[model samples]
Target: MDFLRWTLIFLVLALVSAALGFGGFAADFAYIGKILFFIFLVLFIVGLIFGRGRGRTL
Candidate 1:
């Protein structure tokens, strides 16, 4: 969750920086955002696979 939020934040920052003509900063932010998003995706999938059937009590 936190990783996803930071990914989005960095993506937005990258877009804004690109719009403002800061090419180097934009590229760096975009790269970092992409890496974070992938990490989030992998973690989410792992959780889904390994964390099933534990939400209720008998």
Candidate 2:
């Protein structure tokens, strides 16, 4: 959850920086955002696969 949030923040920052003409900062932020997104995606998939059998009792 936190990871996703940061990824979004970075992406937004990247866009804003690019609009402001801060090419270097924008590129760096974009790269970081992309990496974070991939990490979050992998974690989500892993959770789905491994965290699926521990809920509720009838």
- TM, every model: 0.90, 0.89
Regions of model 1 farther than 4 Å from truth: 55-58
Q: What tens-digit string does per-residue lDDT give for candidate 1 at 11-49?
A: 999999999999999999999999999999999999998
- Model 2: worst 10 consecutive residues (lDDT sum): 48-57
Clash count (model 1, backbone only): 0
lDDT of 2 by residue, 1-58 (tens): 8889999999999999999999999999999999999999999999998888778669
Model 2: residue 16 alpha-carbon error in angstroms:
0.4
For candidate 2, give the lDDT: 0.97
TM-score of 1: 0.90
**What overall lDDT goes with each candidate model?**
0.97, 0.97
User: What is the Cα-based lDDT of residue 18 in candidate 2?
Assistant: 100
